[model samples]
Target: MSRTPPARFTRPRIALLAAGALVAGAAGTAAAANPDTRENAAAAPGCTVDYKVQNQWDTGFTTAVTVTNTGDPAGSWQVEWSFAGNQKITQGWNTQISQSGTAVTAKNVSYNGSLGTGASASFGFNASYSGTNAIPTVFKLNGVTCTTGPGGPGGPTDPPDPTDPPAGARVDNPYQGAKVYVNPEWAAKARSEPGGSRIAGQPTGVWLDRIAAINGVNGGMGLRAHLDEALRQKSDGELVVQLVVYNLPGRDCAALASNGELGPTEIDRYKTAYIDPIAEILADEKYSGLRIVTTVEIDSLPNLVTNTGGRPTATPQCDTMKANGNYVKGVGYALNKLGDVPNVYNYVDAGHHGWIGWDDNFGPSADLFKQAATAEGATVNDVHGFITNTANYSALKEDHFKVTDTVAGKSVRESKWVDWNRYVDELSFAQAFRDKLVSVGFDSGIGMLIDTSRNGWGGTARPTQPGPTTNVDTYVNGGRYDRRIHVGNWCNQSGAGLGERPQTAPASGIDAYVWVKPPGESDGASKEIPNDEGKGFDRMCDPTYEGNPRNGFNMSGALPNAPLSGHWFSAQFQELMKNAYPPLP
Candidate 1:
C-alpha cells in the first residue's frame, strides 16, 4: 500500500495591520446635560431603554443603560439616543460608541451583540456635561424609535430581570439528556501542574478530548481500552465518547512539528493496523449503548485542497499521498468502517473559520466534506456535522475591525468574510458554513462544533469592552485582542486565553460548541529539544526567527521552551487562565 504524505494545517492570518497609519478620529466634545431634554426621552420600537445615572460630577457623569430586545432574536443591534444638553460621551464599554453633535449611537460588541427575545444587554459610558445633566428623550433600536410607555409589541409589561434567560427563546440545547465525554487525562494533567486550579473554573471538566494519531509507527491502546473507558464513563451519564481519528500517511503534510511517524506507503498497514481495529472495537455489541463520535482525519482532506498551490511545501510523503490517493482512500475507509457501527457519530474536521472561512474557501470546503461522505459506502447520513476552529483560536467575535473595500465601494469587512452586515466572528462563520453545507445536499440538521478551547486569547491590547473608534487598526488593535504573531502561526501562540465554555445549542445552526482540543496542550515545542519523537521543530515555534512566507510569523510571542504539540506546557496554561475572557473565578 502506498502511504502518502499527510496534509498540512496552519493557523488563519492574524490581524494584517493596515498599510497606512491609523488616522485618529475626532473625540466628542464635552457637554452639560440640559434639563429640557429629560422629558423628551421616550423609547420606541419593540425594545425599551432604561437609562440611569450611576454617578454624577460637576463636569461629567457616568451612566449605565440597559437595552432590552423584546421583539425577536437580534444577532446584532444599534442603539441611538440624543443628548438633551451639551453632554458628550468621552468613553464607553460593552459597545461601539460614536457621537455626532448631540446624537449618540452605540453598537453592540461582538460577544454581547446577540439579543434573544426579551433579553437585555447593558453598556455604560462616561460623558462630560455642561450646564444641566438632562437625559435625552429619544431612543431607538435598529432605527425604530423606542417607547417609554408600556412596552411595544411582544414585549413584557414589566422588564424581565436582566439576569433571567430570555423568555421566548430556546437558548440551550434541546437534547437535554445528551452529555459529551470529557477526557479525564486533561483534568489530571491540569491539577498536577501550576495554575491547574484555574481549570476547575473553566469548562475543562466538561470538554471533549481527542484520542488522536494512529500513525503506523506509534502503538495505540486497542479498542478494548477505548471501549472500557467509554463504558465506565457512561455510568457518569455521558452518552457519547469523542475521539479524534488523526492518522494519515504523511500525517500533518510536511509540517515538521506535527509530522506523524506514519509514512506514505502504509495504507494497507493503516487500515489493517488502525481503522479496522478501531472500527471493530467500536462496533462491539457490548458497547452499543455508547455513542462514539469520531472526528475523522482532521487536516487531511482539507490539506489536499489548501496545499495545492505548491506553497507551504509538502513533504515527499504528501506528494505520494496526492499521487496515490491514499488520504481519501483512508478517510473513506475510516468513515465507512466507523459508520457501520450504529452507535457511532462521525464529524469530519473542516479546519477552522480562519482556514476555510473565506467565500472562495467554504464552498470548496463543503464540497470536500461531501466528497468524503460519498467516498465509501458511507453516505451523508454517516456524517453528523463539521468541526471548526478545532484546536485553533480565531476569535468568537472580532468586534472593532471594519473595512471598506476600495474597488467594490462596499465594506469588504461586511462581505462574505463578514456576511456583508455583521462583523464576521466565529459564530457567523460557523452559521454560514453550516448553511453552505446544507445547500450542497448535506442534511440541514447537520450541526457544527467549534473548539473554544484556546481561541479565547484576546491580546493584551484588547479593551475590557468596546468603545468609540474611527481608525481601523486602532479599533482592532485596541478593542479586539488576538495574540498570534501572525494569523498563520499555529503553534503555542502567545497571549491566548480560554474561549467560551463548552455549551450545547449555543445558537441556531450550531448543535454543540465543544472544546475538542483541551486547553493546556501545546501546539508545538517553542524550540527544538532532545526528545526523540518524530515531531520536528518548525521555525514558526522559534521566538527569534522573524517569520516566513507560508506563515509570515516568527512566533516570538509563543511560550518559551514549550513541549511538542499535544504535550503539557505549564506557562501557557497559566497564561490562558489569566487571560480567559469571562475571567476565571
Candidate 2:
C-alpha cells in the first residue's frame, strides 16, 4: 500500500469539574487511602467524565478516566483535562496522551475513537508530583464543559446489563456460539460460479493487505464497510468478523510475489499509515459489539527463524529484516495497538509444520514470537493466540500415518517427505506449538487457529489408508495427503483442494478451524506478470521453474496461468471445488 500523510490531530478544549486530593506516603510505598472517585454532571448534547485516582505513592500516582458521550454519536473523540498541582505525566496507555504546561490531552487512539451515545471510553496515566496530587476541577470532551454534579447517563449509578458482554471485553472463544460474517463480495463471486453455492455462505478472512485496503481498494469494501455489514448480519446474536492484518513494512521478506510497498526501513510509515488507521477503525464504537479476530502479519515471524541468521535458506531480504528489527517492531506495534480494543483478538501467524516443525526451527520460532510479542511496548498479553498454515496448503491431519510410525525398521521421520520434521500435519504442529508458546510465557488459555482452507488434499489422489510397508519413502509418499511436490512448494499448488469447513473447537487446544485464506485467491502469478501492488513474480509460483533450497530444489508444482497474489484465479477455484476433501455434493 502507498503511504499516506499522517493524520492531523484536532485539539478542542472541553471541561468537566472533578475534585480530589492524594494522601502522601513514604517515598517508595503507596499511600494508605481508599481509591478516589470523581464524577461529572450530565450535559445535554455533551458528555460525562469519571476520573479516579487508581493508585498513589509519596511522589507518583496513577489515574484512570472514563468519558461517556451522552449526546449524539461521535466518529472520533478526545478528552482533555488540567492538573491543578505540579503532577507531571510519566506515561499512559489506552490513549494518546500529551502534556503542555499544566494542561493534558488524552486523545483517543485508532481503536477507541468512536464514542456512541452513552458509550464510555477509558484511559489511564502515571504521573509524578512533589506536592499534593490534586484532581483537576475540570474535564472536557470535545469543547463541551462537564459540570461537577451527580451521575448522569451511563454514570456509575446506571449499571450496564449483566447479560450483555462488557464493552470491549473478550470471550474465551469468539467463534463459540457466534456466527462468523460471510463477506458479501466474496460470496457474490462464489455464487456466480457453478456449484459455488455449497461453500459460498462460509466465512473467510477479509485481507487488509495494504493501507489502501483500510479505506477501500479500487472502490472495494473498506474495513469500516465490512464491520457495518457484519453488524447488519449479526441480528441479535454474537458474530465474528475475521480480518487478515497482513501489511507490514517489507512484508514477507523471505519471498517475492508478496513484497509490500513499504521498504525494509519504513517502520514509521507502517505505524502511522498502515497499522494506526486500521486500529482506529476497529476501535470505533459503531463496531464494538462484533467480535473481530485479526490474523496478524502472515509469513513474517517464521522467516526470522527458518530463513535468516546465515541459514541455508536465508535470503538477503530476511537478513535485512533481522538486522533492521522492523519485522519484530512492526508485529509488536500492531499487537500493542490492536490489542487495546478489548473485543479484538490478535492471532499472530505461525508458519505451518512444513516450514517450522523441525527440531532446529520449532523452539527458536517460539522464542522469536515472544521477542516480537514483547517488542514496541507490547506484552505477551497483547496476543490472543497464534494461527498456523494461513494461506498455505498444509493438510489439517495426516490420518494415514503418524510421525511416530516406523516402516521396515525406519521411523516416519526418516522418510524424505517427513524430512525429520516432528509433525505430520498442521493439526499436530499447531497443538504442540501451543504448548511450546505457553512454555515461553504466553498465557496458557491461548488457543490455536488452523487454516483449513486449501489443505484438504481430497481429490481422487487422496489416500484412504496407510500404504504397504514396502519402504519408508514409498509408504510415506504414497499415503501422504498433501500432494504438493514438497511441503515448501507454497504457491498456487497443483491439485490442491479445499480442506475443512469453518468450525469451532474441533480438537484440544484448537479454538477454531477457519478458512482464513479465502478459496479462489491466487497465491501469486504463474509467470512474470506484475502491476502496482508491489507484488513481484516468484519462481515458486511458476508452473515449471526449478525450486530453490526453500522448496528442496523440486519443480514449482504450481498451477499454470495464475494471477498476482490475492487476485482471483478461476481455474484454481474450479480445481479446488473439484478436489474439495469432503466432496461437494
Candidate 3:
C-alpha cells in the first residue's frame, strides 16, 4: 500500500509617542523612537538599527530588526540590545540569538556574515514577556552605538547603498524582484509537444533526485551546468534557481513509486555523497549572485508522522525508517550543510493538506520537523521556509466551499472527501501549519511556498458554483475542483492541470507560487518496469488497483500507460495544459 498522495508533497509595539531626534547618551549611545512600533537606535558610530514589533499577544511578541552598516565594510556583523522588561526570546531565525537576562545578542550566521558599508541585514525573533513589552532604547552594531539623529553619524541622510548586494545576505523573499531560472532541458521537452510552447519557457524545479544527478545523469545538465545556465538567464539583478534536494536514505518510505537508491541506514553516504557535494557547488563564489532555492527532501519526514507505528497507513518500510532515525538525521544534515551556502535558501518539504491536515497528523508533523531541524547540529535557522505540495495534485484553493462550511447542518469536513481534515485546500493548510510551526519553535518570519504545478483541476468539469445543499457529500463532490477519486491518488493524476503561474508573494505568509514538480513528468509507472534509479512500481500508480487506508480504499484514479517517475509523460502533459485553471491562453 502506497501512502503517497499527490507527488511529493509578533507584535510588538512599543513606542515612545513622538518622532523625536535621538538623545545621545554616554559612550556614543543614541536612542530614538517613532509614534509607530519601529524604533531606531545608533550602534557605535558606524551602524543604525531599526527594530519593529511585528505582532503581540498576551504573553509573547515577535519583532523584526534591521542593522545597517554605515562605516567601513566588514566581513561579519552583530547587533546587541537590552530589554527593559523581563522578556525572553523563545526562538529566532536568520541569526544566532542568545539572551543573558534582559541583554540580548544576535550574531550573523555563516551565510549572512558579510556586511558591506551601507548594507543591511535583517533578522527576527519570537519572545515571551510579562507586563510591558517596552522597546529597547539602545542598540549596538558590532559594538558601535547606532546614531539616527539629524546630521548625526549613521543618520537618515546617509542611507544604505541601494546598489550594493549584502555579500551573502538573503532577501526577505528570494522570488520577489527576481526572474526564476527556466530549465532549457525541461523547456525543450515541453516545446516538442504540440502547443507546448505556451508553457515551455515557464520556470520549473531542477530535480537532483539521485546522486547521478549531481553530475550529469545520462549526459544531462549537472548542478554546475544548471547554475551556469541560471547565470546566463540572469543577465543582471537577482535570479532564483529552484533545486529539488531529494535522495534521502530510505526515501519515500511510505511509497514504492519513488523509492531511493540508498539503503535504510545510509545516513553517512547521504551526507558525504549527496548533500555535501551540492553544498560545495552552491557555496562556490561563481553562483553566489544567483538566489538558489532548495526544496529539501520531499516525502521523507511526513511518513514518520502519518505512516509509521501503528497507524492504519503504516508501512514496514516507514516503521524501519522511523526506527533507524535516518529520515530526521538526513534532513538535519541536509539543512545544516546546504544552509551554509550564503545564497542558498533551504525550504523543507511539508506534505500537502490531504496527507497531514487531520488532527492527528498536523501537530506531530510540525513537531517532527523541529526535531529534524535540531538534530545533527541543524537549527531552525537553517530552514529559510517550507514548500508544500511539491509534486502532488492538491488544489491551491477551493473557491466554492471551505472546511468550516456546514452543508445540510453538518460541517463539510464530515464529507468523505474532506474526512474530518482541518483544511479543505492547500492555502489554508499551509498558513495554519506555518503558525503551528512557529508555536513549536520555528522562526516567526518563516514563509511558505505552494507548488501550483499540477493542482489546478480546471477543464469542462470544473465547478463554477457551489454544489446543491442536498447533503455534505453532494455539496463537496459537486463543488470541488479536484477531480481525484481520493486526494491520496497521487500518481500522474488524470484530471490534474497546471495551477497558477509562478508568482511572488501570492498571499500572506506565502513566499511564492512555484512549480517545483515539472509538469509532463510522470509520478511513477502505471506498471512495474525495471529501472536502476531505485524507483519501484507501486499499486497506487496503477489505474485498476484498489486503494488503501491512506486513500480511503477508493480506486487509484491514476492515468494509464504512465512511464517511470520523473520521466516525461506526453499524454499527461497535454491533459494538464488542456485543463489548466485560469485556462492557458
Candidate 4:
C-alpha cells in the first residue's frame, strides 16, 4: 500500500490500478479461504490439520492452524492439541481457546464452528516459549485424531504446496521425501571443524549433517557432480535437490566478488555450457521424480534498476548486459529449457525489499522479470515463483511506523531519493511485489520465496519495544524495520545472525522461505585469498578498502580479511549459532 507520490510513474500507476481491481479475483484469496482439503477423510472423519509457524522472534512466536472437514457436515467442532515442548497458548483467533499446562483446547467460533464437509476454517494465536518451539504433535477434532495434512503422519505439519494449487492451498512440497540432499561439501567442511559452536552439544557440523543446498553454476560443483549427488541421495524414492542457475553473462555487475567467467559475448556458452547441459540431465526420464528448484540469476536484474540512475553507483557491465540482452535472453533460454521439464521449478530472482521496495522500483522490477521470462520463451506456466533477498539479508518485519509518517511535508520516513511509500518490511514488500507481478502478467498462483539466510539478527539496534518517537528517523532507527548495517551490504556482514530455518508453510503469499545462501558459507572474502572456485574478488568484501563510489556505499560492519564467498568460516558460524533468533535447533 504505497502512498501516491507527487511524481508517479505511469506504468506503476496503471499496474497498481489494475492490481487494485483484480486483486479480489486473485489466487491467494481462494487459498486462504479454503485450506488444503483431501478427498479421503481424516482418521476421525477426514479432518485435515495444517500447522504453520507463522511469525517468530527471539522468544515469542505466532502460529496458524487450519482445520478442514472432509467428512460429514458438522454442527459444531472442537480442536484439541498438546504442546510438544513446554508451549503455552497465550492468545488465539477464529476460536475460543483455553490452555492448561501442556494441553490446549479450541472450540470454533460461532461463524466457523459449523462447517460443511468440504469447507475449511483457519485460526491463529500468539504464544511465548523459552526454548524448542517445536510444533504440536497431536490434534483431535471432537476427541477424534486428525491426520497430518501433507508432511507426514508422524507430525502435524503443513508443508508448502509446490504446484499452482487452488487459491489459498499450496502444492505438497517436493522436499517431503525421507531425506533431502544437503551438499556434502558444505556439511563436511562445517563438521570437519575440530572445535566451534556445538549443536545438540555436538559440534556445529552435526547440525548441517543432513541439510539441503544448491549446486550453483559459477563457483559450485558442476552440473554433472550435482546430478550425481542427487542420484546418490535419491537411493530409492524421489530426490529433491536445490540448484542455483547463476553465471549468466555479466553475472554480478554491482559487486566484484561474484563477477562470473562469462562475458557479454559468451551468451551461447551460457546456454551450451551451463543451462542446456543441466536441463538435459534434469529432463532425463530415469530421474523422473527428482525435483530441481532452480533459482535463476541473483543481483543481475536489480542492478539494471538500482545500479543505474547513478544512485548507489551504476556498472558498465550492467549497461552492456542490458544492451546485449544477455541476462534476459539467458534467463529466457533457461526457463524455456527448464520449464519443459516436469519436475523442475524455475524461480526467477526478484531482488529483495531493499532494492525494489519503493513504488517506482517495485513495478519496474516486476516488468523486468516478466520481460526476462518472455524473452526466454516462457509462458506464465513456465515460471513458478520469484525469489527475493537471494544471498542477501533483509529484515522480515517492520516493528515501527506512525500514521503521520505518511504525510508528505512532515515525514522523516522518506529516504533521500525514493519515497518510503508502501512497504515497511520484507514481508510487505514481498506481498506487494507478488501482487505487482500478477498485475504484470505472471500467473496469479505465482508464489514468493525469500532467502532468509542472515536476516534474523534482532538485538538492541533493532526495535524490541515500540512507542511514540520524536520523528520518523527515530521511529526508523529505533523502531521501523531492520537493523542491518546497510541493506546493500551483501558480503559477509559482521553482526548478521541466522534467520528462520528452511521451512515450507511460511506466512501467506510466500511459498517457501529457503536458505538459498547456506549458513556458514561466505558471501566473498575481505582479502584476495586463494580459492579453487573461479569467483572474482571485489573490494566490497574488504573492510579496509575505501568504498565503491559508484554504488555510494561503504563496507560497514563487514568481516575483514574473510575467506572467498561460499567457503566455510568457523568464526562466523560460531557467531550465527550464538545469536540465532528463535534459537536454532
Candidate 5:
C-alpha cells in the first residue's frame, strides 16, 4: 500500500467539463428529482466544494469528494486541486489526472462518465507535500463543489495491522497436549518449567543437560546451549523444545567459486563461525538427550548459482575451516566430531514437492543439503532426514495466504519469480521425501520434518489460520512426531505466533524443532530486486530455492545499525518474547 503520486495525469480535463454540465443541468434536475431527495439535498445556490487528502496505511486511499450531481445522468465530472500555496504533489494514480504550477486535476475515468444528482464518485491521490498547508479550495470538480473525505496520513487512523502484533499475543494453540519450544532468552532465565511440560532444550539423561555434554565435550554454542536449557527446565519432559536452523552461506547455489582461490581467508572464518562450533559440541559428554540438528537448506547457498545438480554440487565444496571462511567447514568438519554429536539429528530441506510437480528441483536441493550435512560429519542419528516447505516452500499447504490462483496450470503459480512450483502436496510430497531418505539406505530411524508452519486445508484454498499444524504421525514413526519448521518473524515484529510447538514427535530420534536464526535478525535478501542483485539481502536467500524466503519486504522505519544489533529484529523479538512468556500467568 505504499502509494506514489499519480504518474503524470491520467486525465486533467474531467472537472472542467463536468463543471459546465452541472451549471446547465442544475436547474433541470432541481425540477425533476423526487421531492424528498431534493429536500435532503444541500439547500444552496452555488456548488460548495469540500476538498481533502489522506494516505491510508497498507491500502490506498479514497479521496471521497461528494460530487453533488446537481445535474442528471450521474456521470462525467472533472476534479481539480489548484495548489494555490506552495503545496505540491510528489506522486498519484488511478485517474487520467494532470498537474500545472499549482493545480492537480482529475477527470471522470473513461468507464463511468456521469454522476446524477447527489451521486458521487470518489478519487484520491497518495502524495508528498511541502510547506505547511493543505491544497487550496479554488480547485473544483466541473465547477461543481463537493464534500471531502477524511484527510490525513491514510486518513487519521492507526497504522495498518503489521504481520506481528506489538504486545505479545495469546496465540492459544488448538493442540493442547503437544510439546513445544520457546525462544532462547525465555529458556535462559527461566523461573521454572510449567507443570506437565517437558523441556526440549537438553535432556538431563546423558547428552545435553550437564555442562560437560554441551560445553566441554560438544562445543557449539547457539543450538547446544539452547538444547541444554530445554533439558534443565523440563518439569515433566513435556515441553517440546522446538528449534529451526537454515544456515545457508549464500542463499543461492553459487556462493563460493573456488574456495581456496577466491577470498583471502575463507577457511579460518568458516571454522570460527561454523566448524569450530560443531567441534565444541563433539567434545561434550552431555550430547545424549538433546534435539540438536544441522539442517541443510536446499539450493540455499546464495553464492552457488551454477551449482544446481544435486547433492553432488554441494558435496564437493568443502568448508575448509582450516582456511578462513566464517562458517563451519562442510559436513566433513562436523562429522569429524561424531560420537559427541549424538542424538543431534539433521534435516535436509526438500524444497517442497510442489517443485517436484513443476520440475523436480527441490528434491535435489534436499539431497544436496543432506549430502553437505553428511560431509560435515553429521551421522544417521544427528542428520537423520530432510524437511520441505519451510517458509514459502511453494507448497500446497499455505496455512497463511491460502495459496490458490486463477492460473489454470496447477492450483497455483510456480512462484512469483522462479519457475519452480510453490504449492506442495503435503502428504504426497512428505511421502516422497520420506521415501527418498528411506531409499538412501536410511532404513530404520529416518523421516522428514514437514515444515508445518505454512500448512492449512489439504485441498482447494481459503483464509487459513491456526498458523501451521503438524502431522508427524501420519508420515513418520507411526506418528511419534519429530522436528518441524516454522517462522517467528525474523524482524521480531509482534503478531507472528512462534512458540506453539507441535505435540507429535516425542521420541529420541525425531528431535524437537529449534529456531536456528535469532528471530528479528535477517538471513538477507536475494540478488533479485534492483538494490539486491549479486549480493544477498541476507545470508539465507536462495533465489533458486527457499532461502528463508520473505513473504514481503516491509520497510517500517529506519534501518538497524549492524548485523549484531539487528535493531528492528530485536524489537520484533522483544515483542514475540512479551507474547510467548507474558508477565501474567
Candidate 6:
C-alpha cells in the first residue's frame, strides 16, 4: 500500500512566553463589569449592600457581589440586605462584605469605598454555595431602608422575606464567539511563552494550548487549572480558549483505528482532565467572562498515530485505538455537563468531512454528534463540523497527499505521500465539512476553528547529516498536517520546516484557526529515510531513537528530534503565537 502521509491538524497558537503576557487588548478588557449593573445593585436599604448567590449543585457556588457609586453627595451610605438563610458570600468585591448564614454586612471598601451616589463603580467577588439559594429580602441604604423599587428587566427586586431574587435577574452567557484551549504539561510550558513573548490575556481573547491532558480533577483541565489566571489577567470580553484534551487512555492515529482506549476511557479522562478544569477555573472570580471550547486533536495526534503505550498493531486497524468507546463516554460526559461551567463550551470532532468525500451527508454523521451530546448527558455545545477545505475556490489541504519523489527520497522507503502544493486545497475540504456540520445540528452561530499545526510529511526541511534532508523553510512538511495525516511519531528527527505561526484563523476565511499542537514536539515514533530511525521528539530525540544521547525530557537547545528544545522550540512557538494573536500589548 502507498504510505501517503496523513493530514495535519492545528489550533490557535498556544501562549508561549519568556515574560508574562498582558494578553491581546487586555487593557480594553479590564472594564468587564458593567458599571450600570453595579449601580443598580447598589441602590438598597442601609448602604450595607449584602448579596447572595445560588443555582449550584453540592459545593459549586462561586459568586460574590460588591457595591459602589458615583461621586455624588452623601458621606456615609451604608448598603445592607437580608438573605434567605442558604447562600453565603465567600469573598467580597470592593468592600469587606461578610455573610453569616442569612444575615450579611456590606461595609465601605477602603480604596473603592464611597458611593457618593454616582462615581460609576461596582464590586464583585466569588463564593461557594448551592441548592435552593435565593436573593436577600430587604436592602437597606444608609442605615435606613431606601425601599428599592421594582427591579426592572435584567434586575433583581426586593419582596417581603423574598427568598429568591426577582425572576428576571439572570444574566446571559457572554462567552459567545470565543475560543479556549487545554494541554498537557509540555504543551502547558509552551503556551506560557509562545515565540519568546508571553501571549497577552484580555477579556474575549484566546488561550492557545500546549497539550490536552485529561487526567483528574486537580490534574485535569478543570476550572481549578487556568481559570484564576484567565480571570485575574484580564477583565473584559470572554476568556475564550481553544481546549484540546488529548488524554485518551488508549488512542489510535494514522487514518482510522479500533484503539478504543483512546476512545471512551480517554474521554472519561477528558471529563476529569478537560471538563473539570473549566469548572475548577470557573471557581475563581476571574473566569466570570471566560469561555472555554475544546480544540479537536488540538495538539499532535501522537496518541492517535504514535503509541506512547506500545507499537501499533497496524495502521487503519483501530484495535489499539479502541481502548474505550471511542473515548465517547468521556466526551459525552463533557458534552452533557459543560453547560454548568461558568463560561464553558465545546466542539465535537467533525473530522475534515472532505476525507469522507464531498457528497457525504452531514446528517449521516449524526451518530457521532448525538453520542457526543445526549449519550454522556452533556450540554453538547457544538461540533468540529468541517476540518478540511477539500473543495473550494482555494482548494486547501493540510496534508501532502501529493508528494514528489525528491522529497520522499530524502527520507525513508518509497511511499505515496501528500502533495505540498495541493495541500492548501484542504481548506476547501474544510468548508464542505462546515456545511455538513451545520446540517447536523450545531449552534447556528457558534464559531468553528481550523488547526494548521503541521503539514503531515516528515521534514527533510533543512539539510542535516542525520535528519530528513533538504530545504531551509518549507513548513514542517508544509504544516504539521503533513506528519500527521498518515505518518508515525517523531517526524521531527530534524525539523518540521516549522511554519511561521498563523495570525488568526486561516485568513483564508475561517471562523477561527489556532495551533492545537505545541510546536517542536515529537510525533511519537517514525522512520525517515535519511534519519532511518525514530524522528519524534519524545522518542526519537530522546537520544534513544538512534541510541544517541539526546537526553530525556531534560534535553535543551537545538538538537535532532527535540522539537521542544527550550530555545529552539521556543522560537517555533514564538512564530505560532504571532500567527495566532497579535503581540500582547
For each candidate, the alpha-carbon lDDT, in order, equals 0.62, 0.80, 0.81, 0.62, 0.35, 0.36
lDDT of 3 by residue, 1-585 (tens): 111111110221112111111111111224332212334633324666767554454566556566767766789888888989999998676689999998899999887788876676767666778898888867887787764466443356667756444545677667755667889999999989997876776789999999989999988999999999989878765678999999999899988999989999999999899988998999899988988899999989999998988989999999999999999999998888887777778899999999999999999999999999888878887887899999989998898998889977899989999989999999999999989999999888788999999998999999999888899999999999998999888888888889876655656788888889999999999999999999999999999999999888999989999999999999999999999985664
In each prediction, how many residue pairs overlap at the backbone (N, C-alpha, C within less than 3 A)? 37, 7, 20, 18, 144, 189
Pairs clashing within candidate 2 = 14-140, 15-139, 15-140, 16-138, 16-139, 110-280, 111-283
Per-model TM-score versus the true fold: 0.65, 0.72, 0.73, 0.70, 0.40, 0.43
Which model is ahead, 2 or 4, in terms of lDDT?
Answer: 2
Residues 1-585, model 1: lDDT tens digits: 212211111122111110000110111211111113345553223666656553344566556666777565678999898887898887776688999998899998877778776677767665777698877666888876664543432235655545332322211222223444445556667767764644532223222112233322145443465557657755643355677787676777746677665677788877787777777777678887765667787677767666654646444556667677778777877877887676666778887766666565668878877876777466776666777887776787765554332223344453322333232467777877878898999866667777787777644545675333443333444545565655556777777888765554546666656667777777787678655556778777776767765454344456678888777778888877777764543
Q: Taking the tens digit of each residue's C-alpha lDDT, what string does model 2 give over 31-144?
A: 111112345533346667756554454566656566777776888788777788898887676688999999998888886688887777766566778777777756677766
Q: Which ten residues in a row have the lowest lDDT in candidate 3?
A: 16-25
**Global lDDT of model 2:** 0.80
In candidate 2, stretches whose alpha carbon ends up further than 4 angstroms from where it belongs are 1-168
Best by TM-score: 3
Candidate 6 lDDT over 1-585, as tens digits, reads 111111112233222111011122211111112223464455322222223221122443323333333223464445566656555555543456777667766665554343455332233333445565555546554455433233421134433533222221211211212223323444445446633223221112132222232233335443345554445533543335545443444433432211222333344455565556644554355554555555433211222323223442233333344344554554455444554453444555544422333232234444455555555555334332323311001112433323232443342112222222212244554554455455656544334444545432223432222223343124234433333323222223222333312223322225444444445443332322222221122333333343222122232222333332211354444433343211111
Q: Which ten residues in a row have the lowest lDDT in candidate 6?
A: 14-23
lDDT winner between 3 and 4, please give it: 3
Question: Model 1 reaches what TM-score against the true structure?
Answer: 0.65
Error of model 6, residue 163, in angstroms = 34
